[model samples]
Each structure stands twice: as structure tokens, then as C-alpha cells.
Target: IVLAPVSLAAEDPLPSWRDGPGKAAIVEFVARVTRQDSAGYVEPHERIATFDNDGTLWSEQPLYFQAYYALDRIRDMAADHPEWKEREPYRSALAGDVKGLAAQGKGPVVEMLVAAHANVTTEAFTRSVAHWLATARHPRTGRLFTEMVYQPMLELLEYLRANDFKVFIVSGGGIDFIRVFSHERYGVPPEQVVGTTGGARFELRDGIPVVVKTGDISLIDDKAGKPVGIWRHIGRRPIFAAGNSDGDLQMLQYTTVARNEDDTTPRLGLIVHHTDGEREFEYDRESAVGRLDRALDMAPEQGWLVVDMKRDWRRVFPVAGS
Candidate 1:
């Protein structure tokens, strides 16, 4: 009796990824940590993977899609606060001048949106975001912002989850904003997302309990804050971390850098390098949004795998309707 040969292609976990060092590295790391007989085996409960959302999992070009959301919100609010029509940032946002609004820096743009969210019921804010995501299309791609998420990363997330890894999103974008679509887009639930958070005030609104955004940020989950957010939200060091910019340097270090001499558990740190200008926008070290500078410089020293977008991903955005 003879048996038919098995197909390796049918078992390829990350089909969107090209056959290259970056994809091979991720597959190898997952195999090593999940194999119970391997020395690098990690318990399912301890397998935490944190990813930076914007450039790491999705496209962050022209401006962060969140910034675009905020800009649109500013325009919507202009009717309520007519003074905003003349206000600096508001004026630019009202004009749909993405470059002008981005020039104000991500911080100010973040603050602008949070301010709009201020004093509103959490339910209301969530609805507004949901509405925007449903209707708003990327300025360049003409696809909905959520449609721009990286297919390779989505496959990576699925691969990790199949191995029993708990994935969390740690980003500089608004926590409340990301929560609106995190589960639907990345299969990551709201609770697993940790990001720049605004202070909230709990109060009774017309016989019901409500939480209102106070326009006061409690944390900015980027750069050094990333590690702190991970600790505060997850309560444990991540075994794997992925990011795309200098903002992720500290988190990468926190994940891969050994705490002490005896800490020898296998760890992985990955950086998504935007090298494909034809399929995607390319900027690093010098670009304002999602700048990948020092992190790129130190990736080699840190044993981090820097994935070149042009070379590693067979496709960037998910195919429509897939």
C-alpha cells in the first residue's frame, strides 16, 4: 500500500508573506516556542505578542488614518464651535488640508481629536468613530481606511493565535479610537488594546451611568511609554513584539533585551520596514509620520528582524472582499 504525498503549500501559515528571511524567521520562532519538546517552548499562557498598530499592521501614509479621522471630526464640530472655522488647526482640518494638519505634529492632532471626544458619552464617541470608518476612504487609495491593513500582518496574527499566543495592540493612537475596530479588523478585542488614553469621568446621564472623555490624556503609548503601557495593561513582558518606527524602539528592547544573565527564554522582535514605494509609500529616518530611524540603526544590534515591505510581503493590502 502506498500513501499520497502531503502538500506543504496547504500548510503554509503565512501565504501572504514571500519566501524570505523575514517570513522564515517568524515561522521558525513560532515553531520553536510552540513545540513542547523544544527548549525554547513557551507556555500558552505566557505567549504574549504585542504589535504597534499603525505602520506595523496597517498603512500609515499621507497621515495616520486616525489623524484623518480627527481632521474630519474637527470639520464636523466646526458647526458647534464656529470659532474653529478660523482657529489654526481647526481651520486646516476644516479645509481638508492633511499636510497642514499633519504639520502640527501627531501630538497636537491627537489632542485635537480627544478634545472633540471630550465631554461626550463613550457610546457617542464610539458611534462617531464607527460611522467614520464606514464612510471614510483613504485619501490616496480610495479604499476604506480599515481596508488598508497589511495582509501579511493579518496572516501573521492568525498564525500566532493558532499557536495560542495572546496578541495585544500597543500604539500611540487613541485607545478608544482603536478599540472601535480592533476586534473586527485584527481579531484583537478592546481590552487587549492599550494606547494613548484620555482621562474619563463617570457620571449619571439622564438616569443612566456614562463615562465621558475629559480631554485629558492619561498616557501616550509610544516610544518609552510603550513598555509602560504593556506592563500596565498586560502585567507581563511580551515574548514577541512588532513595530515599524523609532517609536517602537523601547518596546522592542524591552521584549528582546535580556533582563538578567539567566533569562534565556527565546524572544522575538520585528520591525516592518517601508521599502516598497511602488506598492506603498516609503519613508524612514526622515519622515514625520511613523519615522523609522534609530530603531533601524539599532535593529542589527538587537537581533531584531527588520522586514522589508517590498521584498517580504507578496501583497500589501488585503484583496477586496477577501
Candidate 2:
């Protein structure tokens, strides 16, 4: 049989990606599921795609953006609470010592986060996050946190949506915090964002019903919890899932790996490997935040695509002016 000549210009969906196996897999998969004549063609409603926010969708270092915001909040609130100066985690966070806080382990860190984030109404918290995101700049790149989003991923989101896929962000970050910027920056609406949630209460304040954030642990949407969050919020199993760390392993598995004997649907799992130290942060396995150890090892065995940032992406963030 004679083969038809393919037009590179006409077929390029992810233009920011260099020609490679990773990019080829994405294009081919999307085509196979979206093409009318293809056996794997899926209906629009079944085209659910979920992505992790930090590191996967945008930069998550020198630390997770939410953690940075929490630290900043703690510092801002320190003047009102002089006791923080004598406290272990608060003192370190106030001094801008991230390593010191990490040394104290997850307990102290969670305490600090709760102190900084809770006890406000949902609306108030949303506004606070909005203002912080608007003003806060990433120390390394000197770019606004929202501006640090990956351009290639932004294109991918648009590309997926164009193919009738509904994209959702399933992250370990705070749900409210991510909702504040996810819609405006990533095109993923607040309703489509599923993340770690803090306890909330309904209260009538001055005759207005308000939902207030309480200092209580709710869902920590990471690792095994990712799949649980997906079930609780999304209701439908995603056909495509992307993440950057071991924290996202369960999410990738839930989306791609077949479970029951009766289930048969094409799925894709992608892991974003941070390999570009020059343009961005290079980290995996040994890193404190966004560690990619278990997920990295499992990707090959599961047929998941691992995107090498330095090799696969033609560009990291969007152009300075653009």
C-alpha cells in the first residue's frame, strides 16, 4: 500500500514540543481517541483529562507556591502574634528559613499552614489568595507566581479542550487557593479543581450565610488520596492524567491502568520530569518537594510517558514579552 505524505505544519498540535517519542505519543493518542474513523474514538463526555497543578502544570520550586504563600502569611501575621517569634516552626518560617521548618517535619509545617490559612470565611480566604498571587513574585525567576505557568502545558490544555476533552486540575495544593488562580491562569475552572481541602463551617454573619474555614484537617489530596479526590469530585475516571511526583502515582494509575475485567478504555499517563536545571529547576527522587522517585521508576513498567523538560520542551515558560 502507498503511504500519504504527512504535512508537519498541518499536523502540529503541540508546537512548543520538540520532535520526540514523548510528543509523538501525545499526538498519536489524541488522534486515535478523537478521530471519527479510529477504533479508539471516544465521545466528548468520556474525554476527561486531569492534571496536577504544581510542577506538572507550572513551576513548584523553590517550593510549592501555596507553601510560599503560607510562609508569607505567617510573616505578615507575626506582628499581631508575638508568640510566633518563640515558636519552633513559626520562628523558622518568619526568619525565611525553609530548611529549618522542614527539619521539624510535617507536623510543624501543617501547624504553620493551618495557623496562616484557617479561621477565615471562604470568600475572605479567596480574596487573600487572589491579592497574594497578584503581588507575589517567584524569588528565582522574579516572575509573578501566576506568570510562572508552563506555556507548553497551557497549549496542551487548549489542544485537549479543542478535541472535546474536559480538563481538570487534581492537585495536592489547597482547593480554595488553587481555585483562586486556576481559572484565570490555566483555563481550568474552579469547579474542575480538586485539591486538599481544609475543614469548613456554615455560619450566619450579620444575616449573611458564609462558609468559614476552620482549623481542621480534611483531605490531603496526594498519593493514594489523589484517586479518592478524583472519585469524590470528578465522578468520572479520567482518560488522561499528568503529574510530576510520586504524590501523583495513584492518580496516574487510577487514570491509565486497567482494573476490572469488564473495563476496556484507552488511557494515557504522563509524568513531567524536571530535567532542565538551567532554564528551570532540576529535581527528582532526592528533592524535598515534588519528589519524583517512585513515579519515575513505575512510568516505564506502566507504559506512562515521562517528559524530559530539557530535551522535550522547546521552551519552558512563555517568552518574556509574549
**Residue runs of model 2 more than 4 Å from their true location after superposition:** 1-11, 82-88, 102-111
Candidate 1, residues 1-322, lDDT tens digits: the string is 8898999647988988999888889989998999999999999999999999989999988898998888777766778898887776788888888778767766777788888888998999999999999999987889999999999999999999999999999999999999999999999999999999889999998889999999988988989999999999999999999999999999999999998998998999999999999998999988878899999999998899999999888999899755
Highest lDDT model number: 1
Taking the tens digit of each residue's C-alpha lDDT, what string does model 2 give over 231-277? 99989899999999998899999999887875667799999999999
Q: Could you tell me how far off, in angstroms, the CA of residue 38 lies in candidate 2 after the best superposition?
A: 2.1
Clashing residue pair totals per candidate (backbone < 3 A) = 0, 0
Model 2 Cα displacement at 73 (Å)?
A: 0.8
lDDT of 1 at 156: 94
Q: How does each model score on lDDT?
A: 0.91, 0.86
Clashing pairs in 1: none
lDDT score, residue 105, model 2?
43
